[model samples]
Target: MSDKRPLLDTSDIESEKDGIMGAKESSLLMTGITYKSTTVAPTVVWYGRQLLVRRKLFVGLLVVFIFSYFLIGPADVLDLDNVDSIVQVHHQSNVLDREVNQKLLLPKGYLVYSNQCRIVDLDPYKREVMRHFKRVSYKPCKQRLPLTQMRYDDHTRRYVLSINSTAFQSYHVKNVLSCCYMGVERVSESNVSYTHCEHFKSKAQISNTTDSVIVKCSTEKGQIYINGHATIPERLQIRQRLKQWKRRDQGRRVPSVLMIGIDSISRVNLIRAMPKTAQYLYDNDWFELAGYNKIDDNTFPNIMALMVGYNLSNAMKYCNPYVSGGLDKCDFVWKLYKKHGYVTSYGEDAVKINTFNYLKKGFKQPPVDYYLRPYLSAAEKLLDGNVVLGLPHCLGFETESEHVYNYALEFARRYRNDSFFGFFWTNTHSHGDISQTSSMDDYLKDYLQRLLAQGTLEHSIVVFFSDHGLRFGPTRSTWSGHLEERLPFLFIWLPPFLRAERPEFVKALRENRNRLTTPYDLHMTLKHILTLSGRTGKLETLDGAKDCPQCQSLLLPVPLNRSCEDVAIEDHWCTCWSYKAINKNSKTMRHLGERVVHYLNDYVTSFRNGSLAHLCQPLTLQGISAAYKARLSDDDPSQTQIYWLTFSTAPNQALYEATVRYNKSSTSEDNVQVTGSVSRLNSYSGEADCMNDFAIKKYCYCHHKSG
Candidate 1:
């Protein structure tokens, strides 16, 4: 104590205290804090610095965690299951950034409203249509190992059959695989039956007289029989067939025609479901018809329009598909092509639901030189496959569609140098779930690439097209679905030489893309191909569609003012008109729905000369589901106000959709006529088991079923 008093004076102590106070004040000032002298400012400043350091560390760690979560998360989180998932993710992102309200402006002053019909690829409403069904990837069944295999020897022009020893051993059966060839024959237009075994052998060299053969495999004893297989021996019988061509001209090069048809796909759906194939087509500068509308309700009418240039009424009158040898009498364009020295081939994947053979007489004779019906007819019975999405998915080791493609490829390869016309239609894969079309993308792209690599397209015209959109599905209920069902995908590709020589035709096709078109125009286009030459000024004039005389080839420019009526497009199947939503619960809509149901009942009661009147119970309006009024532009002055109503019915709770015309100018009951066929929105399978008429089956509810 004595030393501290002596060592430090009062002034020294005061000076040291003042310096410490000044440092504290500076720290408080830097931190923008004003406090009384009694407060501990330095302690507060120290705590603030420590908290800031901790926050920075926490933020850095949080960001690292987020990055790791995204990088190491389950793949399904980012993987899109179908078109709907892709659209939803895109739509959600767009919603976060800005409002999304997009519309596709159609030609002739028509507008495709986003609120009504959304054909836009990324529209969120696509989710609504797709949500009804689960996303389905092609999980093909395991490859079925056959007891025998057939290989075609081009040198011998015969099929060599071989037995698989391993397959026989795996079954713990005898390796003695005896086989016999069942010859295929057309009994009648509606019937294709096979003959009994003619040449039975353990190892056989089959004749190339027939295009398809059913080879039955069994043990030598004829017991414990093995499954058989349908073989299509790809034989180039060009020398024999070319002898029929009398008007052969080696001087001029005519384009080969190849039509690859996929059933029940819309133009927009093409982009959504088969992006890779669509992109390949786009990248190759394929001419796509934006306004290619369907002419009628289903594949029969629409396809007939293209094949024969005839409407349903005219086709029934002229072709009469129900009668034997009636289709043979029809003037199909393929006949014309054949007469003009072109090798013609026609094939379809699904034999049961083939365009010509589905509940109708096919052809008394083979329609084309290389017909695939006999092969498919036999394959359906012998092949082991699964019925996926209500259609056959696989045939043994390959998908059903692959058989069609392989057949087409072989046909093209065989006739690459000749002027040929090949029509290959596939229904199994695309006709089912719309999402299943995605499975065909890479394969289709590869197919086209193969065609390109083989130089098959050097002097050829390829048409990749569809009949219509989904005719029966959960999608069929949406507004976009309505339009999609009307507008099918149509693409035309010309050879590079043709594109370079006939720039005018390419230009016209590009211009015609936005204009209204139909299968009638396509029929004319095929005819126009018959006249295409290396030297071009103007293509020769060909007869137009019988029903639609105004329809012309796609190589010519389509009129901008062209109406759906000009192209023979029915009002129900016309996509040129826009619609706006109306109140579904309103009195007017309710009455309209009732009227529609009444009309449906009357239709069933009067159908087929009152045949269904006794069998089908009368349908009553259960409730109105949705309603829309047509919004016609100034250009369509003659069109009356139309209403599209969707409603449910009693007994089955069956959904029905129809387009009704309400003429305010008239004072008659006929003013409210249904424009097109009344669509049954839901399945009426068991209820309509009594009837076979495809048209009446939709409205009929059998009296046999318990109420």
Candidate 2:
């Protein structure tokens, strides 16, 4: 081996100790090559140990880099801050895919009308109509020298009627304050009689007395000094009823139902007229029925559909308001609630044109346990009030609608601990002019806020809704108004408890917003509320509407392909079908207009056994003003083209709007038929004075006036 462990050179030892040397020298030393040897071995075994140490160090660094790259993730390793952003991007992509699928599944023209009839707040036509009604600052009537004040004492659980002595002192008159309990007596189905006056003591516990009372202060000379009306809510009775119900139905939880209704206000009009209230409802997560279509022309039939779940013909046959006690036989939803140990109440403003009593005999008996008609009637009769917008605006230093709201608030407060059903409607502000709806925006918003703050909505199902839109006005002529007139505002709120317990129902409600809905659906929803229980479980089966068997609870999903016929909505009132302008001068439009005019004339002639044929002048189409052809949906295979015509008739130059359906598939002469009743677009006040039939009056032009 020639001494493999040869003597180490002094310079090699010094260089190795210093860790510095030329590559060849270090290699020669490590490889054990002799300093005198000029040839070196190709394999350097001595340096293998040093090379292995370096290889291990490099492998350790490589492992650490791989471990760190995976541990921190590629985004983090690349110093990017979009980890959550990436997740959000995926989530948005999934949502978009879902929406696209939904759109693909929807039938054509499903929401076309809604998309086309978007009414902006500052629409030129609406603004022009608004100009007719000058903006008047709202001023609450000054409180008169108070004669009486009714309040509930929470601690005492009794209502206290306080006599205000200020009226006597301020007027410098001495009088005896005498109060009499005024009880409502249903003498007949169409009539109500107030009970004989019974002496009542002032500042006395009137909780046991009737709900309303008449108070009068007389001078010594027997001259009436002050007269006022007071309403005493029966809180004690409500509590008792609740206690009995709780015992009878233990562990069953039912939400209190409160409905606040406005007349002639549409979905978009509500937003335009009452922006604050709409925004408040939006912020509070109220579920809005975007496609709630009216079933009839005006409030009466529409409200009847909601309360009685009956269509016009069925309602007339079953719940004839003209017939004595007919409405009593009608299955009003509130009666169901009342039977189930819930305190029920009904109130409305605009006494003359009130929903139930407008030219129709209202309920003969007090429909609800707490009725507001008597008090409102007494107030309107006894109190000094002023008319605004063709209706009583104020009664005794308070707005007419304010009385209804106040009564509703008191009723809600009184029955806060009890299960109750209350329907309060106000028409004084919104019934006549659409612009007047703005006057009630702040007040209505405040009322809703108070309901929330006072905890009335804690366990309540509140519905803030409307009947229909502007029935007759400049706004009605606009395309937006045509859609808005049918799509009234319908917003519903479910309590937190119910929302958490019945998530499926809430989900269905949210989904039904875009589906075509009607008052019949609302009727089923009310019925569904009666079935809810305290325990978390599935909802019970609900009965469908009388007229519309397919109409179910709005708390349940409404079919996307549901049409006007599905929900018992007439073609005249249905806004689901999209419309496009057609040339009025076109021959087809002219023929359609003539057919519509002839339909109206025939409608008038057919009434009362054709007795009015001579009394009413035959209507001839003067000209077609505006014509639109309906864009049929894909599901409709009948090939029935619906044409909406706004045309003038001769003799009266009366403008009439009618919906005529022309069946292209039919070979019969009756292929063209009027879908529904004709709408009198102009004032037919004096033109149809010869006819007493309200339906015939729209089309009948008096023969005497024709000359």
Candidate 3:
């Protein structure tokens, strides 16, 4: 025992360093033998080397996969850069059925017809029939188009030209329905007061004088029930009211030029509202010297057409408003007085904020010295006595109408002596706060009467119109407004200076000038008034009118006969767009861009009809509100797209489903969050049973109790 204790010397030092378990194991092994133990070191392994050997396959595969995604994947598709070139297969064409005519939504009076003529089917005459002159509708077809059909029509003949202007017997497709007269009343010797005409049995008065003229018109398309459900005429009735209107205007002097700028306006309503405005504009004493015709009923395109002497779908786009030369850019009127070099102005609040933006691309700032820019500078350039085509904003609510009126009056008073070219007034006074601007119509009548008394509209050709109709409906709400808001009133006053060409010109204009006109025809109308003949949209610019391209307006609408033999299917193989074609041959993803543009063009229509239905569909909003709230709260914007789909309420079958896989920055487990959205092109209720399907099968067989 004494020897063992003595041997427990410095050995304990190394013993302590090693674990007690290791020392015991060593002692146990050395127990029976003569132990000659010594401390020794063992070799260790590097983690990097071992790791490389153990996961060599995984590392190699990951690198190859990443390289494949960025490099090889692109090569496999059409070789291209950006979204347009990526080889994406759209298996379904955007072809549609039961398509509605766009003209149906256009402002009232506008119409669309086929450009081709065919033989009357039911008629035994088998004579050349131009059903093309009627409004667009499904009709039976039996035309074996002759070789002459290959030829393009003249540009000036672009209007729904009839093989026979009054082919009443060839009423192959009768769209003409009832016609209406606008509400009008002479408020003064020179001015007029107007309102919408609710009934056909109303007396009206108008005059041509040095003061302002006003007109108002209104109409609605609704089922006319006899007792309760028995409806009157199903289609619109085209009364022979044009003849009466001609008689009213025949004795008057139409303004040399009339400027109509409907704030947030469309074309159809303009047609219904035109009679009152027209009667006032052409009253005997005004510029009545007019030789003008109307083009189409659309406003923006019509105006542009009137300005540029080309169709809305003109091949050489861009109506460079500032340009002085070239027949292509300038309408006949502008071409006539390019040297007059008058400025254009938009002092009236009528110019929509987005108007200029839509006119030019990336116009975060105004386009410098642009052709339309002159419309903004017209009031300033009176010294040189230049021709001016000017429009000023008619802002309200913030600014008093009287103040704006007086301000404009001051400007006109100063510039009356100049040989002015053109003018457009916003007419803010016509707008209503029927609740606030003066509850009583008498108040507005009197206020307007006072303005007339001031006699400021003494000299110039004047025309008045509202871009919209009253917001009032059957029921009254403060927030109540018209669906496609329009203020339908236009008045015009013209001076004696342009009076030289009155006799013959006034007669033609008195008979036909007020027909359906596009805003594009405004320039054409002005030119004709200036005694310069040109054709454009048939309006003032008849001298500058041009043709639309063949492919655009031509639609192969489904037929009424419903015979498979009646339907013609042509080769669509040439329509197959190859990846190379998109990448190299096409213009800026030509095919893809066109589809996108079409989708955009048609998307708004869904909102006007389908989306509204979905939104107001008592069940949809109640069912999906939770989902929408959840979706909108998301920090990511992409999540909202799905929410939109839900709000759109697209049916399961209607929705076009797509799944995109992307690598994320997380080094954790793979997870996916399901989302939803509806089509912008078409509206439908989008629903699902299993949202988080591991497989992106967009189909659903179950429905949750709505919300």
Ranking by TM-score: 1, 2, 3
Error of 3 at 657 (Å): 25
Overall lDDT per candidate, in order of appearance: 0.71, 0.70, 0.26
Tens digit per residue, CA lDDT, model 2, 256-337: 9999999999877776667677777876777877678889887878888898888777887888776657788888889878
The clash count for each model shown is: 0, 2, 79
Q: Name the TM-score of candidate 2.
A: 0.76
On TM-score, the stronger of 1 and 3 is 1
By lDDT, who's the top model here? 1
Per-residue lDDT over 493-522 for candidate 3, one digit per residue giving the tens place of the 0 to 100 score: 434433355444333333222222222234
lDDT tens readout by residue for model 1, 1-707: 01110111233245446644654564454445334566658886776787677566556645644553353231111212432434211111121112111212332223222222212222222334545444345564554366666666768767776666566565555566556667666565435677778655546776666666666656656644334334445445655555445234546667899999999988867766776677777767778776688888889888899989998888988988777889999989889887667788888988878888877878989888878777777677776777877888887667888889878887787778777899999999888676787777778889999999988889899999999988777777766577777778888988988888888887787666666788999998988888773322344455678899889989888776677666777677766555666678998788778888888888887876787689888988899887877666544455467788888999878988888887767778887778768877777768888876666777888888965
- What TM-score does prediction 3 earn? 0.31
**lDDT assessment of candidate 1:** 0.71
As for lDDT, the candidate ahead, 1 or 2, is: 1
Better of 1 and 2 by TM-score: 1
| Per-model RMSD to reference | 16.5, 23.9, 33.7
Worst 10 residues of 3 by lDDT: 226-235
How close is every model to the real structure, measured as TM-score? 0.78, 0.76, 0.31
